[model samples]
Target: RRAAAAQGTSLYEEEEILLALIGGKDYNDDSKCKKKLEEYCQGLENASLKKKEIHEKLKDLCEVGKADTKCQALKTKVTKKCTDFKTQKLEQAVKNPSDDNCKENERQCLFLEG
Candidate 1:
């Protein structure tokens, strides 16, 4: 209908517009099928718009090593932080439970110091 309005022809009369509006196996050019195509296009447009909007919302404007002060989502914030360090620490801590040097250093130089 929109294509027909835009170019003054039915969807079939405007071959390119019809094809452009239609996609893969989910919809065809029959009566009910065309209705389905229009509905799918609306849904696709809405989802695309939402994805673009979410990309904008999740965007971080920080330099290297700087946390996004305003980004409060734990999952997203963790993506920006160093998880490699946590994995490395777990590997080391598991491999040698009695590594006093690492433990003592962390005790004095890490949270204990702060």
Candidate 2:
């Protein structure tokens, strides 16, 4: 719980729900689940960093009066892509909660929703 909290994600709740769904059976090893959660958190952090970088770059461009059509288009495209991806993942998770892939989708959706 501390680790997930440090990562700025509520993964402990997700883990508990996952464990319940699996009838309390461990995922091969508890460490594997922890490792996976850590990886997911790291991935989320990296994505946020990238988003910040993009925003900063865009801001810098605008401040210098060089904000071009392409830059705005790219930003809009990226935003749309992110929204579409989240929606798709959430729909997949909701449509097939019992599928193996949907378990991962659920985690991704939960993180994105948060």
Candidate 3:
């Protein structure tokens, strides 16, 4: 759907701008970065849970023929976006290679694997 595609494109563009802004800053404190990453991961997890809940509700509606195909499509889009964000953060952690960043990256890997 053109609307979903447009939304994805806008989301990607917005994330790019946000990353650009963040990359411009000099993070001398690894603790701060680690804290931020933790918060971000938590937020991502919460968002994923909320999306799942919404999908289930929509699925119930669909079963009654009250919902359309857009619900699943939106879930897919959101999952992809979250994945893209995680990948980008992992790449940044690899580039920095701080102790905290490494731990965070490992934690993320385990989280993803599990």
Candidate 4:
């Protein structure tokens, strides 16, 4: 449509308009998908950080005393974040299994799981 409007004569075919719309939609979808993948990556990083913090806290508590009162809650938080990260990556994989991002996420999930 923009291409047609920019033309000196302003002549445009219906098919050209439709194709432009379709092309724009495809570009938008790709952009959105890339954004989603970046968000998932950030989520995974956050979850890893949370889990590491919990581990460090647990270590500190163990060094200071034998009390484990807060251990369960911390464990639950780590588990939940790990699960959420994995779920997002898995969903991305299912959506675009052949994509590099999906494959990288799969690898990251496996590493995180182990």
Question: Using Cα atoms with residue i matched to residue i, what is each candidate's TM-score against the true structure?
Answer: 0.22, 0.27, 0.27, 0.33
What are the lDDT figures for the candidates, one per model? Answer: 0.36, 0.43, 0.41, 0.40
lDDT by residue for model 3 over 1-114, one digit each (tens)?
244354443222433223222222212233443344344435546766454553232223223322223332433444564487578887787677787775444433533332
Best by lDDT: 2
Query: Which residue pairs collide, candidate 2?
Result: none
Ranking by TM-score: 4, 3, 2, 1
Tens-digit per-residue lDDT, 1-114, candidate 4: 233354432322322222222223222244443343344335546776444554232233322222233332333444464577668766766776776664345433533433
Positional deviation of residue 56's Cα in model 1 after best superposition, in angstroms: 28
By TM-score, the better pick of 2 and 4 is 4
Tell me which residue pairs clash in candidate 3. none
Off by over 4 Å in 2: 1-63, 66-71, 98-114
Greater lDDT among 2 and 4 belongs to 2
* Candidate RMSDs in order: 24.7, 17.4, 16.6, 22.2
lDDT (tens digit, per residue) of candidate 2 on 1-114: 444565566653432343323222322344543444344435546776444554232223222323233233433443464577667765666676676655445444443333
**Stretch of 10 with least lDDT, candidate 2:** 19-28
Model 4, residue 37: C-alpha shift (Å): 35
What RMSD value applies to candidate 2? Answer: 17.4
Candidate 3 to native Cα RMSD, angstroms: 16.6
